[model samples]
Target chain A: MSVSTSQALDYLEQLPVQTHRKLYEQPSTVLAIFRCMLPHLAKSIVMGMLYMPTPISSPDLDAWFRPSAAKLKRSSLEILEKLHIVSQKQLDAVKHTAFTLSPGFAKSLRQALEGSGTHRSFGVPAPPTSARKVSVAELDDYARIQWESILFYMVGSTVGFHGGGGMARDIGKGTRSLLEAGDFVGKKFGGGVGITRTGFMFVLQDTNAQVWSLLIEYLKHVNQLGMSETDVLSFLFMLGSLELGQDYSTSTLSPTQLQMLIDLTAFGLVYRTSENASTFYPTRLATTLTSDSGALSATNNPHDHAPAPSGGATQKGFIIVETNYRIYAYTSSLLQIAVLSLFCKLTTRFPNLVSGKLTRASISRAVQTGISADQILSYLDSHAHPQMQKSVPFLPPTVTDQIRLWELEGERLECTDGYMLREFPSDKDYRDMVKYAEDLGVLVWKDDGERKFFVNRIEQMQEALKKQGQRRAR
Target chain B: MVKAVRGTLVKCDASIKAMLVDIDSKNNNDFIIEELDEEHMLVKETKVNALKNRLQQMMKDRLKDPTIDEDSGKE
Candidate 1:
């Protein structure tokens, strides 16, 4: 799973079981979850079990995987168990274990794969009517304009790019308040909004990730809006499954989903002729929700004229960074230029190209603004010129290393939110607990002499302690 | 041993090609997994053999009569 999908999965796993059961009732939702949310190995495991008549025995499943891959298998199974997608059973007096897909998940997934269900959850295509049909190209243009307006709204005040006018002002009130609530932007002293650190991180992300980030934030506020979270989520998943450019009827949507459609339209996930339109066309942003980020750039809307430095219909990279730290980007979008200027000492801008240099001052300023060096590096890497892509470590190793060093110069201390454990009854117990925490990958720091350790999470450690207690009792 | 290795490689290549074809049929043509070269052939051969064995086991299980005791053991 990519970072965004894992975040969504983490949120999904936290929901009550009833919500999950309800979500699994929709084949489209199940398919979208299967396609994007599960780890690659977990997907394989699920697919293997999907058509099997009986539960897969633990030993058999273990034997299918290389011994070296056991750790991956364990973690994948752990996530599956947590999501209630799979259940384990002890099959014999000797405690032979078996695993099976949860019935709801298996049935819904089968229905999705077969495309046999009467469930119109995937979406119902709008009937041809007097409503003027919107072209895919127009929808793409609409989505990009609406999306960029929101981004420009966040960035314009901070970068003093407000003179462009009207574009940023067009961002809807609901969207602006949502951005404020999420702390992506804050109201400034005298007047307008200022972009926050989170906003900087958000703007630097690829469009698909940015959209998911915003939607996930919107998901957090669903309850406050007096809507059922599951219904909204299922509708979002359904939008992901919809074929882009096809108009889907609004007739079938519940009141919550209808309200969501209005908000989604503002975010450019869906396009409608007007608020009262009976049908809406999902933009590329909506349809590609469940795909990996790599797949996103390939299917970027043909009419998405965002002057991103890479990968629209042209299939060419636009950003080139030299070993000497000079940078050039072939883009005309004010939004992209503003994003680049956030981390570069840009000196000149031409009709189609912008030139900049990555100086220590610029990088440090960006770091201080809460944009990490790694995020900057990745943004550069993802947008590196095709010529750069031919080489290993796309960005020059010197430039990448120097940027990290600059970030490190900003601070000498690192902080972690966690708990410290000390005062062990025995040295042996402390060693055991430390080793267990290390295995769990939660141990942040430990000292043998002091018999003290720190862990970022305690739930798994508590379980380990309970098992240790049981062993001691035995 | 050489023949077994060769056989496994051939089978692995065929299965992988089949899977790629399946993916392509689904319109996910962007992903193109290249065939294994001589350098990695031996490693890939073993991996494929393991997968083939698991697949055969799955097929065998599918052909067998359903076991009623399987449900009785569920927690």
Candidate 2:
């Protein structure tokens, strides 16, 4: 799983069980969740159990994995159990444990993999009509224009690059409010909109991650808009599963899904010909939601056949960073340029290329804006020119390290939000709990002398404590 | 050991290369499955069988007539 998928999964795992159960009813949703949300080992386990007559016994499951991978297997199963995708049944007398896939998940995933269900949740393709069919290229153009308009609106206003003459001025009212709602942008004292820290993070991300971030924001606000969250989510998943070139009909969608289509269209996720168009097309942005961000920037957009002037050899990557902190980007896209300007002191611009230098002042300015050096480095790394990709780190080590060093100069203190455990009944108890928390990968800090520790998450630690108590009692 | 798995699978069946590619595409390059031994292949085959059975069960649950057995092995 990539960062975006894990982020989505984190949101999904927080929902109520009823919502998860309802979501599992859709084959497309199940397929999308399985394809992107689960870890590699979890997917393997699910696939291994999909067609079995009997639940996989604990010993059998353990034997399937190498001994060295026992920890990974345990963690994967832990996540699977937590998500209620798989349940464990303990056999009596012999005390053997067996794992079974949740019936709803199994059925839906099976239907999805075999494409056997008539659920139409995968989306119903629009029947061919003579109503001036929109080509995929046109849809791509529409999506790019609408998406860039939103991005430029967020970036241009912050950097004081006014006179966003045409498209940026026409950003939909719904999108503006949504951005405000997500705290990606805020209204200034002078009645003008300004970008927020979250907005900076959003801008630095690749296009696919940016789209997911926006949609996830939209998902958070669905309930207040009188829309069913499950329906909206399943529809979004369906959009992710849809073929990029094909048009899906709106007739089969529920009222909630239909309402979501309007918002999604404004976000440039799905393109519709007009307000009441009968069919909608999923853009590359939408279709790549369930894919890793790395694969997304690497693959060429099939609809994009436009000639690459220079660094546009890759679909979205155009930036080339040298060890000397010199940056060259071959992109005429204003949104890309605006984002680059946030952290790079751009010196000159050609027809399809822009050259810049990463200076200490520029790095510190970006860091002050709440854009971390890591984010800037990752953005540059992901957008590195194909020629630069031939090297191991993609970006030069000196440049990446220097950016971090510059940011580090601005601050000293680091903070983490978590619980600190102290004053245990005994040192042994503290040691045990600390070790357990450490094993769970949640321990942040510990003091052996004080018999105290801190953990990033307490739920798992609480559970371990309870189990330990039970064992002690036994 | 890794090379042995790749050699065995690649030498035994040319079709497995296409199957590996399909898996790779589905995974979105998170990790590539470049090799599989006969033992692992058998394990996967059982999983495939389990999936087929589950699909049949799903057809029974959802379909009125339940005559889609021919499409079960399509994937």
Candidate 3:
């Protein structure tokens, strides 16, 4: 089956207890899972438990989380249990149940967090040599220039434009072929290959999400070719944890991973000096896979593998859509201007600035191309100037509402895929289960008179059934 | 008869025929000694007072040794 990232994550989540037991034996895997898969508060909880001397009482844990947030706490715990990362035991002659990190996870996490493991999962840095040393700035410039060229290549062909040799040739033929195969581009009805609707959406996403979206697409195709999804995923995680400036030895990687390294290098996700170079360096693009924009922009340390200079935080957002539909952007980047031009009609272009306006016609044209106003608004929101972010609402609420309204006009009735339950044994049983659904935040729609209800997620229902079983046992 | 002092109380005995001023109380400056008992006015150093001083020293010594005081209920 073709496994997307979400599919890969679901596969990881559904691993049998025995598989998790075996996987937790590897410190690298455990550490990688903890860093990437856990939520923000869950990470803090895990860290706190890492060094505790005694099994924490459930009541004590409850006190640790706010009352209103108890549902989140319980869900976090449930996921941890499913992953085999934690265990709860009843104390002798006492009603209290104590929770502790599972021994395997605990030991592995301790090793990973302390950096004491001899496994050397983190790639070894190359020996100091001036000839092959890659500065972070050079790497960032390489990544940005290459990535921008790809966007320009796809977008340029759409507008009957030419980037001459500067942009078109930088991206490899393999990537171009894959883009066409993925339907991100198509053979224009009139003439040359042109951008597709998905192509516009892809171009509009922020760099981080765009990387994820593209990599997910890549992962989906890799499975069809019979590559091991496990090897690809673990290698991607390992790449994320590697130091940005340092080169890593490729000897430890599997053949699939090694091949991936070559393909990734062309995409500017990693760098190597020569085909024979002993080491390879993951670029900032690869390392920032899991970081939010706040971490990306706030940590100004260049050595930390920030994709863009912290100073560029404000410069990235050039477009400001006012309630009156006027748009102003302060950018000279041709790639950004080209993407904006896909949905907006540009009226003026200054030396350091470009001005555009969003009109009903322009928005409707974009909508006709399958690019919703939500995607455009979110794209604008993600790249909003740091100055704009300081305001209470990043975009003018009216503008945001109008964009949603425009998108909503096309989606008069939203469709949801879920399970519906009815005909319970009794009204009391239905009432109790419905109440439980509401508590878990999974109840999408319910009809009391009809005794029918719908839920989008089902994990909580399984637990609720177990509780009912216990009540009957009693 | 003894002669009286000119300003304050006078203490006089018939056999002594001399005057002495009484300054103990301001109520009367002049007075004559009638019958005095010298034996009742004698001063003495007692052993009981020495025992009180010894008791105070013992309490101070006990306070200096905290462990001993803590165990012995000397506080």
Give all TM-scores, in the order shown: 0.78, 0.78, 0.70
Residues A1-474 of candidate 3 have per-residue lDDT tens digits of: 111233335546776777677667667677777876776677778888999878899888888888998778876887687777888898765468989988878888898888886866666666677674788778776666666667787887886667653555558877787688778899888767899988887776656656666676676677776776656766776777777777788888888888888778777788887866778888877886644442223345646454443223223555676777778877766666777787787889897678877755567678868798888887788667677878867889988787677665433222233445566656787899898888777776666886766666766676666666566567
| Residue A53 CA displacement from its true place in model 1, Å | 5.4
Task: Tell me, by TM-score, which candidate is best.
Answer: 2
DockQ of model 1 vs. true complex: 0.01
Off by over 4 Å in 3: A1-26, A48-68, A81-104, A130-132, A162-165, A177-198, A293-299, A302-315, A320-323, A330-332, A347-354, A368-372, A381-398, A459-474, B1-75
Lowest lDDT 10-residue stretch of candidate 2 chain B: B1-10
lDDT of 3: 0.66
Predicted candidate 1 versus true structure: per-residue lDDT over A304-379, tens digit per residue: 5444332232234778999999999987767777778899989898988999899887898899889999999988
lDDT for position A333 in model 2:
63
* DockQ preference between candidates 1 and 3, better one: 1
RMSD of each: 20.6, 20.6, 36.8
Ranked by TM-score, top first: 2, 1, 3
Tens-digit lDDT string for candidate 2 (A1-474) = 877787788888888878988999999999999999999999999999999988988988888999977668888987898788999998765458899999999999999989896899988899988777667667666666777788889988877777644535568889999999999999988988899999999887767677878888988998999999999899889888888878889999999988888888887788887899888889877888887744224445545665432222125567899889899988876667788899998989897788988888788889978899999988888777899999998988999889999897554323344555666767778888877777677776666885766666778777677766666677
Worst 10 residues of 1 chain A by lDDT: A306-315
**DockQ for each candidate?**
0.01, 0.01, 0.00
Candidate 2: where are CA atoms >4 Å away? A54-57, A89-97, A165-169, A293-303, A308-332, A347-356, A384-396, A423-431, B1-75
Please state the Cα-based DockQ of model 3 relative to the true two-chain complex: 0.00
